[model samples]
Target: MVERIDAPAVGAPDPELKNSPIFDESDWDELSLDLELESGVCYFNDRSYAIGEFVCSGDELLRCEERGVWIREGACHD
Candidate 1:
């Protein structure tokens, strides 16, 4: 049987990942605006902007699993 793993606890630090610079202030601002315009929701980086769309809900963000993309609340990581 396949076991299931829970997503990292909300607000928990990510393991198996190293820090890296992702986006500058300007990039974040622009991306935020674009997402808002397209989906009516804004995304912010609690850590770094390298990881985009950390928080999203409504029809704003879509999760892409192996099966396909589906709308859902919260963040999606690859």
Candidate 2:
């Protein structure tokens, strides 16, 4: 079964999604943003990702599994 990713313990609700009626927008935006990770990794209630996964931070793509520390995958292109 699918699990909910919007639980309060995961962190604050993404404002962009919270503002939308259907909540279809992404957590990303035009400016810089941050994510909370536990012990150098993100722990979602249902699953997780490792070093190779692509993390979208604002307009850039960071490649790192560790929280607070990011390895640059470079800026996202249009």
Candidate 3:
């Protein structure tokens, strides 16, 4: 006999995907323009970068991930 696994209820957020970053929507006020997710590019500081690209802001190194999301890789070194 085969068994089936139950999935979480709809609209319920996955706990694994709930990690909070220091930078969030509240920080958008410092930006000149809003970020719009492009087809295959990530938008940061009003600039568009291709996927898997890296961006350096101040001392932070950010990487462009899928879905136009920018994930912090680590600190930027000179």
Candidate 4:
């Protein structure tokens, strides 16, 4: 299941990934130190996130137990 939230801009679609490409090759395995409010934000390795936490670019989908908030990104795959 997926949820939608208002963001600063509409996200572009990526047919190859079957979801919007949040991260590119460079973003792979990078730590998600902070939330992204814009589309196309990437989260890499060992990055901890939380739910209910607003991102600077995108929306939060998964909640992090330690952070006490939701993990957020620019776009999501439904």
- Which one is best on lDDT? 3
lDDT of 1 at 69: 19
* RMSD, every candidate, angstroms: 12.7, 12.8, 16.2, 11.9
User: Which ranges of candidate 2 are over 4 A from the true structure?
Assistant: 1-48, 65-68
Q: Write the per-residue lDDT of candidate 3 for residues 1-49, one digit (tens) a residue.
A: 4332222112222355422122433443453344543347765544556
Residue-level lDDT of model 4, residues 41-77, one tens digit each, is: 2322223233333333333232222223324453443
In order, how many clashes per candidate?
1, 0, 0, 17
Best candidate per TM-score, number?
3
Off by over 4 Å in 4: 10-78
lDDT of 2 by residue, 35-62 (tens): 3333444423223435445444455554
lDDT of 1 by residue, 1-78 (tens): 543323333332245442222232344334443232332232222332222233232213322221111224333332
Candidate number with the higher lDDT (3 or 4): 3
Clash count, predicted structure 1: 1
- Lowest lDDT 10-residue stretch of candidate 4: 58-67
TM-score of candidate 1 on Cα atoms, chains taken together: 0.17
Candidate 1: misplaced stretches above 4 Å?
Answer: 1-59, 74-78
- Model 2, position 63: C-alpha lDDT score: 44
